[model samples]
Target chain A: MKLGRHAFGDDEALMMAIVNRTPDSFFDKGATWAEDAAFARVAEVVAQGAEIVDIGGIKAAPGVEISAAEEKARVVDFVARVRDSYPGLVISVDTWRAEVGAAVCAAGADVLNDAWGGADPELVDVAAEYDAAIICTHTGGVTPRTRPYRIDYDDVVAAAIADTVAYASRALSAGVARESIVIDPAHDFGKNTFHSLEITRRLDEMVATGWPVLVSLSNKDFVGETLGREVGDRLLGTLAATSVCALAGARIYRVHQVPETRQTVDMVWSIAGRRPPLRAIRGLQ
Target chain B: MKALVPGTLALLPSYASIEDPVAPLRAACLDAVGRLGPRVRIVSSAATGGSGARVGAALVAAGGGTVVESGETGVLVVGNGSATRTEKAPGHLDERAAAFDEALRASFAGVDLELAEELWADAACLRDLPPLADAEVLYDDAPYGVQYWVAVWA
Candidate 1:
């Protein structure tokens, strides 16, 4: 997959670390709200071998409205600074606003991670204009920052596949490079706990669609509901889900913990015969 | 012309790791195999399973050589020393392993077959080959607690 300045092999599994710029983001909760703190987070994940840094200006959950101006203010300069500092790092901005997407792209962002499932129709145009990658996601037609209350589907996996594929088609029609487009089943955005779990179980169907799958199964509500663990205690559950996705051939992982997720995916990738052991001399000596 | 290489299963592609543990050994084996010309015969130590034959074929194929049944241009022999060389070796440190390897290294033509079998040494094919006193030794070491040698005689 090509992310603007970088191209990854088909056999590679990439780690996209979450770097939230929001003061009230659920996981970090004002930890990286300061620009310096967020920059430090970028450096830390980079050092931890993350290939991508997903910088988000607004929290996923509902809160006081953040205008596009505020979102651009939060991420544009930070993305520029990170771009200048780490030219090899894939910079992705997690926003649903075309204005924010274009602004960040101008500031050297490589990917527009539309976590709200293409809420802004022009986001794809912005991606094509800037020659940036776009993550087409399935959010069940819900508005941005809204929780999934009373959201039901005949088959959640089918809905996710249909929506994400349609969104991918839209991105393709908008002239987004085929290699730069990625599909995501936006877990917990328009999905309840059970829907997210079902999506995880049937993730291979999404993978079978032939669009590279990006899974944001980080410290989300689904893992919390499954293990009854709070936000800070969901690393193990997230990695377990990540292993399932990796086995099913998810290409990109949007994660909070890079090292743990990388180990899990590498282990599963090797088991699936897609990757070789790093240094295997145990019995073949 | 003829060459000898270790019967290391790690040389096979199926047993390959991302970081090859036997890179230098592989390089030596390939270099020796390349010198065996285009049409060569493989004289592997093991009569059953064909492990040595597989390694020979792979190395020959990689060196742009073909295996021929008769009228061969060169010979590729596959054999190795004892697996019980060190305390952490695969055979768990047999006391006679070092001396057995030393004897075979000096000359494999007159090895004691019963003692070689007891030490888990793969030298049956090497026993029939001539001495390596005048041959060019490409590699000689035991990186993985098991001794390996790559040599060529033109």
Candidate 2:
């Protein structure tokens, strides 16, 4: 699979570390809102061995509206700065606006992480124009930044597969490279706790779709509710969910705790026979 | 020509890890096997289906050498000293492991098979072999609390 300038082999798994530029994000609220602080976060994740850094200017939940101009102001220059600093890092701008996507791509962003599914139809066009990668997420047709209030699906897994695959097709038709397109089952976007659990259980079906699957299960609401833990305390639960997805062949992990999540995925990946152990001796010795 | 390598299964390609646990040992084995020319015979304690011959075969193949049933070019012996070097070792700590390996380091011609078996030593194959007095010792340490050696006699 290809992520912008980097091409990965089939057996590889990637960690896309979340570097928030928003002050109102539920997790790490305002910690990295300052540009310098965000840059420092990028440095930390890079040191922790993350292959990609996903920068988002706005929070996912409903809040004061952020215009395309404001989103561009938040991420465009920052993307350029990160690009100048880390030449090998895969820089992804998380926005649903085609305008902001285009601006960030021009400023050196490699991926457009449209976490709200395909709310903005022109987002794919922006990706195609810049030769950037796109993340086709399954948000169940919800408007951007809106919470899933009593959202129900007969089979959440099937809906995710249908929606993300269709979105991927749309991106492919829009002239995006097939290898650069990725599918994400956006957990808890339009999913209740039960729905999120089922999607996690059946994530292998999404992998079977033959697109590189990206899972954004990083400290999300599903883990919080499932284990009766609040935002700051959900890392263990998040890693538990991550193990399930990693074993089922999810190629990319959008994560908050880079080192911990990487360890979990590497361990599970080895257990699934996709990766070799780091060093093994015991009985063989 | 004759060479000796540890019978550790980790030397086999099928048991390999991303970070090789036996890299130095493997290098020594391959260098010795390569010097043995194109065809070599294997001497190992493990039965036909066991990992001893498999490890020897893999090293031989990697070194561009083939195994021969008769009229062999060289001999590849697979054996090790003891698995009870330390408390954390596979057989736990045995007080006699260090001295037993020391004796084999001096000479392998007169090893007591019953004592070797009791200590979990795979040196039964090395018992009838010539002394190591003239052999070049390539490797002689136990990184994982198990004794291993890679030596060659030319």
Best by TM-score: 1
For residues B82-129, write the lDDT of model 2, one tens digit per residue. Answer: 878999888888999999989998889889777787778887799877
Provide DockQ values for all models, in the order shown. 0.84, 0.86
Please give the distance, in angstroms, between residue B90's alpha carbon in candidate 2 and its true position after superposition: 2.3
The TM-scores of all predictions, comma-separated, are: 0.98, 0.97
Docking class for model 1 is: high
True contacts kept of each: 0.87, 0.90
lDDT of 2 by residue, A192-234 (tens): 9999999999999999999999999988999999999999999
The reply for model 1, stretches above 4 Å from the true place, is none
lDDT of 1 by residue, A1-285 (tens): 899889999999999999999999998899999999999999999999999999999999899999999999999999999999999999999999999999999999999999999889999999999999999999999999988889999999998999989999999899999999999998898889999999999999999999999999998989999999998999999999999999999999999999999999999999999999998887777
- Candidate 2 reaches a DockQ of 0.86
